[model samples]
Structures are given as C-alpha cells and as structure tokens.
Target chain A: MFDISFENAKLFKDCVDAIVNLINEGEFEISSEGITLRAMDPSQIAMVDFKMPKKACSSYKVEGDVKIGVNFEDLSRVMGRARPEESLNLKLKDSRLEMTFKGKFTRRFNLPLLDIGGTVPKEPKIEFDANIKLNASVLKDSLKDASLVSSHVVLSIDKNSFVIEATGDRGDVLIETKKEETVVIAHECTNNAKAMFPLEYLNDILKGADSSTVITLYLKTDAPLKVEYPVGQAEIVYYLAPRIENV
Target chain B: MFDISFENAKLFKDCVDAIVNLINEGEFEISSEGITLRAMDPSQIAMVDFKMPKKACSSYKVEGDVKIGVNFEDLSRVMGRARPEESLNLKLKDSRLEMTFKGKFTRRFNLPLLDIGGTVPKEPKIEFDANIKLNASVLKDSLKDASLVSSHVVLSIDKNSFVIEATGDRGDVLIETKKEETVVIAHECTNNAKAMFPLEYLNDILKGADSSTVITLYLKTDAPLKVEYPVGQAEIVYYLAPRIENV
Candidate 1:
C-alpha cells in the first residue's frame, strides 16, 4: 500500500503547478525516503527536478519502491477543484491514482496513469560561475515586467548587482537589485555571467510563488540558467537553456 | 468636452466586466443624465444594456449629446491593470478615449474609437409571465455547478420554488430553492415558466456578483431571459435568447 497525506492541500497543488508546465508527464519514484521526479521538457530546452521528503507530509507510508507515471494535466485539473482549506490524501491503486480532498465535503478523483515507457534521463551537468539568492517576489515581479516588453529576458550579474532586462518594440524594462537590498540573500560571482532565456517559461515556473519565499539562481555565460525554490518542504529546481543568436 | 471621474476604479471595471463577453464594441451615449450603452452580441444571442448615471461618478461633465464607439476588450485590458483603490478619470479627446488610473503610479491609456456607422438598436421588448428575485451568489453558484455538467441550463419556476437543472453525458445537477430559502427575495408566477439558456453567457454576466447583490430574473416560456443587477449606482441588464432543442 502506498499512501500519503498533507494537512494543506494547497501545498501539494502548488508543488504540482511548479512543474506541470515544464513537463507534461513524469515518472515519480516513491520510496521511504521521499518522492522524486526529474524530467526534461519535450523541446529539450528545459529540465525540471523536484524532491519532497517524507517528513514534508503529515503522514507517509509505503511498502516498497514504487514508480508511478502520471499525466500532469489530469493531476492539475483535479487539484484545481480542491478547496483552499481542504486536506489531501493521495493513494496508488492498481493503474489509477486516487486523490481525495477532505474538508466539509469529501471530493475524490481517480486519475489514470500514463505509460512512460521506462525512459530514464540522466542528470544534467552544467557549470556555473555565479549564484544569486533573492526573494521570489522580486523575480516574479521582474518577470511580469519583462513579459510586457519581450518574449525573452536577459539576466546578467555584475560584481554587486543582478539585473533583469527585456527589450521589445513596445518598450524596454530593466530591474536591478543591488546587494544592499534586503531582497538579495547572497550574491557570489567569480566573473560576470549573462544569458537570455524565454520569459514565458520563467513566468510559468513562478506562478505559485509569493513574496515571502526565497529563490536561488545559478547562471553561466551562454548556458542554461537554474532557478531553485521551495514548495512546502519540497525543493523544486528548473533549468532553462539560453537562446543563441544565429546558432 | 466629455469627462467623467470615478472615485473607485473597480466599480467601473466591474460594470465593463459584466458585459464585455457578450458585446465586443458598443456605442455609448453621453448626456446630462449619465452614460448609457445598448448593444447586441454579434450572433444576436444576447443583448446588453448599461446605464451609469451622473450620480455614479464623483464628477461628470458633458457639453452636449456625444456618441462614442468603444471596444470593450481594449477597455477591459486597461481596467485589468488598475488597482482596486485607484480612482479613474475618463476623457474624450479628438475621437480618442483616454483613461487614467491614479494610484502609486499613474498609468494612462488612449483607446481609439470605432466607427459604428450611426446604428442604434431599439430597446428589446419581451412579455414575461414570471418574475423572480434572488441573491446573486445563489445564481452564480448554481451556474458554476451547472457548467460542470452541461453548457446549457434549464430554469423553471413553479408555485413554491425556483429550480435550475443541467444534464449532460458527464452527469446531471439540480438546484432547487424553496420559497423560504431567504435567498429568494421575491417570486411571482401565475403559471410555470421553463426555458433553457446558454450557461456561459449567464456566467459572464454574473462574474462580479456577490452574495449581497440582488439579481432579478424575468422569464417566459421559450423566450429570452432578462437578468438585471446593480453596479454601484448603475443598473446593468442582460437579455439572453433561449436555445431551442434540435433547432
């Protein structure tokens, strides 16, 4: 039997929202330690990795290692129907995933599992020269401003500041956060790193973020950018490849 | 000069939200009394009528009778950017409608006027045998429940109760409000009146509805349904034609 419960259904819903856009379907490895999922998007331009430890849940139980493949869209629809104050219970039964929201009224949904075909992807390897940690709201707000101007945004880090810039026919937006701003938790850079990535992907990834949460950014010149944030007790990481010019 | 200022931008925004879906563009008549708009949906399935009296605005000024054609979608987009606490000022200048939101940051948008070719529709006339008044929330919640089952909803009123029903392949939902539900403000019917209307149009008209808001329903067998509600000092009314089965 595999069963886990969360006191806050919103947290579980949020965790699913964080990765559902990046990957349509994913195989989750469930064990006594935790539940983990890592996959690359169909276009191979982005990768998503997440881990929710057993302790993150109010109650977690498992008999052995179980691999479950799920269609993210179906799960998202089920979560959307859940009330904010409801608690959630998830169970794996045969080929169906059972999700139950317990509150004033009990609502249950059975989601059909997809066949992932046992395709396992290796961990992505990348080197970064700059790491900046700041408030999630800062990133979220900057992304919104960027989206108004362009479909892609440029991220660059200087010695003491990180900047987000977007240029379009409409207008250009530049948001710079210095080290003195309390929003910046840490700013470390051996050398300046700059990259351009799609703004829509970042906006989708930050949909569930609020001002109180913290996000860390890993950047390298002309390489993929990594954004890390926490969902409940789980840690979600996303890597988006940069757009190359005439390459 | 034609200028009107609102103490609360959200009130004006809500008024536009109530009808934007059914009517794309509308010709508004500005006079000493206030501003009024009457338009039918492109498909002629719904009719929307709105009146914002001079008392509804903090200030109202009009030199003479002025007719301005406006695209509701553009106006709605501008309103979406307005904060709840922001006050709004609207001005007509040289065939352009200018909207300004006063808040932390003053944002201005100039929307171009459309050429409606001086066509004004006469007010719709319908005979109704039944009149029902209920809390907007009850109707809103019932429509949401109905939408889950079907795109069309059946509304019927008998001697003692009002009923809403939707049946689809997925399932069927029936909501009945007894004469003493407290939500039923007034119900008068000489005979039973039953009709089926598109749920989406009704849903759009009630998007900004709250529990305290009262919505009056006028119904006739196989005839259009008339829903009237208040937005601030303005009275907004919608008439939706019934969907005949197998026609």
Candidate 2:
C-alpha cells in the first residue's frame, strides 16, 4: 500500500488535459524513481511524453515499477468530476481502479491494458531551429481568430517577427506581432519557415493554459510542432503532426 | 425607422433571457405603446405569453402600430453574443433587424424575424386564488435539487409551510420550509393543495431569476400555474400547464 497527496488538484488536471488532447490513451510506467512514458500517435504524427517524479509529491513512496496502460480520456473524465476543494486518492481495488475525492465520494472503474502495437520508438534528439517564448493569452487570442477562418493554420517565424495565418473559403485571417512591435522577442532565426497544422488539436492542448502562463514553442521546417506550457507543478509537452501542403 | 440604445447590454440580455425561457419561437408584435406576444408551441404542450409596456422603456416614442413578428429564438441567439460592458444598438436596417454591439471591437449581426403563428389576444383578467411570495433564489435552489431525483415535481402549500417533493425510479427528494420555520409568514392559506408540473418547463421559467428578486407563485389545483418575476423595469409572467393526479 502506498499513498501520495497533492496540495492542489489543478496540477493533475493540466497533465491529464494536455495528454488527453494529444492522445486518447497511452502507456504509463510508475516505478520507484518516478512515472515515465513516451509514445507517438498512430500516424506517427505527434509524440507525447509525460514525467511525474516522486520528489514532486509531498510523499514519494514506491516499492516497484508498474507499467500500466491507462485510457486518459476515462481517467480525465473521472478526475474532471472531482471538486476543487477535495483531495484526490488513487488506489487499486482487486483488479479495478479506485479514485476517492474529498472524504465524501469514491468511484471505481476497470480498465484493460492493451499491448500498444509496434514500438515505433522515440524521436531523435534534434536541436530545434527556432525557439520563441510567448504569452499563452496572446497566442490563444491569435489562434481563436485564425481558427474562425480556416481548418489548418500556417505558422511562420522570422528573426524579428512571428506570424500566424489562416485562409479559407470564408475569409482570411493573419496575425503578426513582432518582438519589438510591443512585446519582447529574442528570435535569432534569420530564415523563415512555414508549416500548416490542425487548429482543433492545438486548441485542445492549450485548454488549461491561463493568461500568465508562458508558452514556449519549438519548430523546424516540415517537422512536428512542439508547444510546452507549465500547468500547476507539472510540465506538459505537446507535439502536433504537420499537414502536408498541396504541391 | 426604429432605433433604441442601451448603455449596458445586460438589460436587454436579462429581458430576452426571461422571455425566451417562458415561450417557444413565436411572433412578437412590437409597437410604440408596448410590445405584445402570445403563442402556443406546435405541440400545444406549452404556451408563452409576453407583454412589455411603453412605460418600461426610458423613452416612449412611437408613431404607428409596428407589428413585427419576431422569432424569439433568433433574437435570443443574437442577444446571447452581446457583452455586458458593450453599448448595444438595436436598429431596423433596410427593414431587416440588426443589432450592433461595441466593446473592445464592433460586431454587427443581422437577424430576420420569422412569421410565427397567432396574435396576442386580449387577456381575460382572472383573480388568482392563492399567492406565495418568496425569493427567486430560494425556489431555484429547491427546484435544482429536486430535479436531480425526478422529472416531475409536486409543489404544495399548507397554512404556514411550503413543500416541494419529487420522486422517480431513482429516489425521492423532499424540501419543506415553513414561514414560522424562518421568520416571515406574510400570508397563509388554510386549504392545502398539491400540483405536479414538468421539471424542464419549470427550469426554463426560472432561468433569469435574480437571488434578491422576489418571485410570486399563483397556484390552483387542477389548473395552470403562473410565476411572476421582475426584470429591470418589466414584470415577466411565466404560465405552465400542471399535471393532474387521480385521487
């Protein structure tokens, strides 16, 4: 028997929200050191990596490594129902999983762990060509406007400016804000790169972000886009598959 | 040519919200003297009757009887997008209904009123038998809890007690709060009566209630029930058909 507690439930909420947006479910391995799992989606389009260390918890008590495949959608739903003021408890009940929130309510659900198909392996450590730090609120606002006009958006970054553009049958929307325009930007990329990506997936990954949260974006030409934001005490890394342009 | 300006959009929102919940999409006759509407849904399961006098507005300006048959639903949707801080302009554009709200930005939408059936017939004045005056907030809470257990609720009143009961396949919920149980027994009815009404219909009528705004309920056994709540400067009366129980 082992127990760990969090001062706030939002940290867990952000992690679940970010992962659920990227993948419906994934393999999670909890060991004596910490919990770690990394995988790319079916199309080899995006990869999601999660790490929740024991030291991050008030109590980091563990005896062995347990690799459990969890359907984050189901777990997120259960966690979503938890009241803000209540403390969350996770435990094993026979073969089912038990979650108790507060001292008042408890829910038990069973999950089947499947052998996640062929191991496509993780991405190679390639240095990102462009790195930019931006406010989540600004990016969120820009995405909202772009999504209104198109299904897929093209993001362009230059040494001095970052641009988001979406054009469709309805209308065209373009949002460009420079580092020196009003906000601070320290972009070093001399050349410009553009890639198209789905808007729905991007919006979902930013669901739990607030105005004050800093969103760091990493990019390379024709490569998966990476968006990283910290939620509560957890760090969430979201990778999105790029849409191929018509030749 | 008709134009009206409201500094705060919420006044219009509150009026539309209360009006929409009580009635189905129907024709509303707008004039310089007052606005009037009366119609029953196609199914005849419910009926909504609305009236707003010229005295309710800041300026009572009119020249002719402008009977524009407005679709309540379309008007509600347009009103839903108005922000409270924005200045709202209601204008007739080329005889087409248009509303422009100016906030951080200007957003204009056009809504065409549909021809709904029926006209507001002269209401036959009737004296209500029993009246109970209570805060809208208190009643809304009671209905919310009772709805959790059943779809049909029974409302009863004794000499000094107010009782609400709802029972379904799941379980039963009962709420009994008396005048003496609190402090105020403004009026009491010695003859006790209970009437059952649909929960969803009741929910609609109570949607725009303000906690501080008092709601007066007029009830009669085997007859329709009427609930009157105050909007900013107008009185909204919601009439609902009651379900009869065979003794």
Candidate 3:
C-alpha cells in the first residue's frame, strides 16, 4: 500500500485541475524518494511533470514501486466537490477511489477506476537557457487578454522588458512590463528568444497556479517551455510545445 | 429607433439568461403589441413562449411588426459581463444590436445581426390546471439537487406535498417539501400528477425568480410546465416540454 496525506485537499485538487487540462491521463510512480509523474499529450504538444515530496505528507509509506493509472479529470471533479476548509484524507481501496473530507459533516465520495490502456512517457532532460521568476497573476492577466486576439501567443524576453504579444485576423494584443514590475529580464549572451505556443494549452496548465503564487519559468530557444508552480508540498512542472512560425 | 432602459444591467442580463437557456437559437418577433417570442426545440421536445405587454415597457414604439434575429447566447454573454450597479441601455441601430453600460466609464458593445435562418411558432392555446405560488429560492434549491441525479426530473404537486424526484443509473435523488414548511400547495384534485422535464430548461427559466419573489406555476398531467417570474414591471412566462417516463 502507498499513501500520502495532506491537511488541505483543495490545494491538491487545484494542482490536479491545472495539469489535467493539459494532459488527459498520467501514470503515477510511487518510490521511496517520493511520488513522481511525467507525461506528455498524445500529440506531444504539451507535457506535465510533477513531484510530491515526503515533506508535504503527514504520513508517507511505500513498500514497493507501483504504477497507478489515474484519470486527472475525474479526480479533479471529485476533489472539486470538497469544501475548502476540509482536511483531506485519500485512500485507495480494492478498485475504487475514496476521499474523506473533514468539515461540517464528514463526507465520503467514491469514484470508479479508469482503465486507460496506454503507457505514459518518462520525463525528458533538457538544458535551459534562461530561468526567471514572475508574479502569477500578472502573467495570467496578460495571457487572458492575448488569447482573445489569437490562438497562439508569442513571448519575447530581452534584457529590460517582458513582452507578450498575440495577433490574428480579428485583432492584436500586446503587453509589456518594465523591470520595476514583476518582470526581471536578463540577457546573458544577448539572446532574444521568441516562442509561439497555443494559448489554450498554457491557460489550462496555469489554472492550478494561484494568483499570489510566484512561478519560475525555464526557457530555451526552439524548445518546449518549462513552468513550475508549487502546490502545497508538491511541485508541478508543465512543458508546452511551441508552434513553429513560418515567416 | 427602438430603445429600452434598465437601472441595473445585470437585472436584464439575468432575465435574458433564463430565456436563452430555455429556448434554442430562434428569431424573436417585435410588434406594436409589445415584444413576443415563441418557439419549440428542433426535436419539439420543449417549447419556450414569452411576451411582454406594451404597458410593461418603459416606452413602446413599434408601428409595424419587426422580426429581429438576435442570437440569445451571444446577447446573453455580452449582458452577463455587465456590472450590477451600471445603468444599461439597449437599442436597435439599423441591422445591429447596441448595448451601453455606464459605470466608472461608459462602455458600448455591438452585436451583429445573426442569420439563424429559422422560424418562431405562434403561441399555442392550452388550458393549464393547478396554479400554486412558491418561493423561488426553495424551488431553485430543490431543482439543483434533482439535477445531480438525472436531467429528466419528475415534479409532482398534490394537495399536501410538492415532490421532485429524479432517479438515474447513477443514483436516486428525492426532494419533497410539504405545505407546512416550504410551500403552500393548492390543487383541484387530490391525486398525484407527475411530469418530467429537462433540468437545464428549468434552471435557465429561473433567472427573474428571486428568493422572496413569488413564482406561479401552472401544471397538468404530462403537459408542459408553465413558470411565471416577475422582473420589475415585466412578467416573463416559460413553458417547458415534458419527458415521458416508464415508471
């Protein structure tokens, strides 16, 4: 039996919601180190890698390495029905998923297990060129406005400004913030990278990222974008494939 | 030039929201007698009929019948964004729909005429039996629970109790409140007459219905349910088709 417990079930639910919107399902690997999950979309357009350390759990136990198949969408829905103040208790039974939330009335909901006949990919190793920390709410607002204009958004970072731009047949949206804002732009080798990615993919993946939470982004030229947001004691990493601009 | 004004944009928005959700995409006919619309779903499973008398309008000016094809969904979305305290103005300009909301700043949004390419049915003449007054919030809450079990909910009103029961493959949900606590049941017959209707249709038509506001329901055995909810000087009526149940 493998189990990890958290005081707040809502926080875990929030993290699952953001990642599930990007990927359909995942294979969670239980180990002595921690619980780790890494997978990409069917078309390899977007990726999600997550790690929940032992510290996040009040009680952690793992007897052997086990691969548990989980449908995040279903899990998120069940988690969403829980109250914010409820202390979350999760346990895996014979074939059903059970949750006990502590609130006005302790309630339990059961969800049937899904047998998605497929194998998830392992986490990829990529060298990043730039690492930057930015405020979560600012980035969310910029992306929301840009999405109204185009399906794909372009993020171009330079030494002094963090710029987000999107243009389509209908209209165009541009957002730029200076160093004084949450934007801390740095150029090591005068490298200016512009990557275009699907706005919906980014939006879905960032749903779990709280407005007050700071997000650290690892960027590279012509490669997938890596975004990491802390969820309780867990770290959720989302990688999005960039759309090649033919110009 | 045609114009209508409301102090709160959200008030109008809530009313329209209930209407659009009840009826499918269809054209509405505006006449000197006041704005009137009636239509049945494509499958003819449900019918939505609405009318506002000329006296109810702030200003009624219609020399001839004007058929305006306003996409209720699109119109509802624009209206849904309106702030609650803002003064709202709706007007028709040539072939366009215009809405102006005043808050800290006056904002205007345009709605292009839609070519839904459909017809609105003439109002049907049907006699309804058993009309009862109810608290809107109590009805809303009861329906909310019933929807969790099945889309087709059976609503029964007897001399002493009003019951809503929905049983599906998932589970069974029953909400029964007696005249002693929740409602004052009135009837011509003491026997039980149950009719089933789509939950979403009922959910939509409850917009103008407030907690303390009284709602008049006209019902019969296997006949469409009629709900009348008042908004300011206007009263909107919704008739929903019923689903035939085996049990």
Write down the RMSD of all candidates, one decimal each. Answer: 9.7, 8.8, 10.0
Docking class of 1: incorrect
Per model, how much of the real contact set is kept? 0.00, 0.00, 0.00
**How many backbone collisions does model 2 have?**
0
Question: What is candidate 2's lDDT per residue for B187-241, written digit by digit as tens?
Answer: 4664666689998888877888877778887776656777777787666776777
TM-score of chain A of 3: 0.88
For candidate 3, list the clashing residue pairs, or say none. none
* Candidate 1 TM-score, C-alpha based: 0.56
Q: Tell me which of candidates 1 and 3 scores higher on lDDT.
A: 1
Q: How does each model score on TM-score?
A: 0.56, 0.56, 0.53
- The fnat score for candidate 1 comes to 0.00
DockQ of 2: 0.04
Higher-TM-score candidate of 2 and 3: 2
lDDT of 2 at B140: 86
By lDDT, the best candidate is: 1
- Candidate 2, residue B125: Cα displacement in angstroms equals 3.0
Ranking, lDDT, top scorer first: 1, 3, 2
Error of 3 at A51 (Å): 1.7
What lDDT does the true structure give each of the candidates?
0.84, 0.69, 0.71
lDDT of 1 at A121: 72
Q: What is the TM-score (0 to 1) of chain A in model 1?
A: 0.93
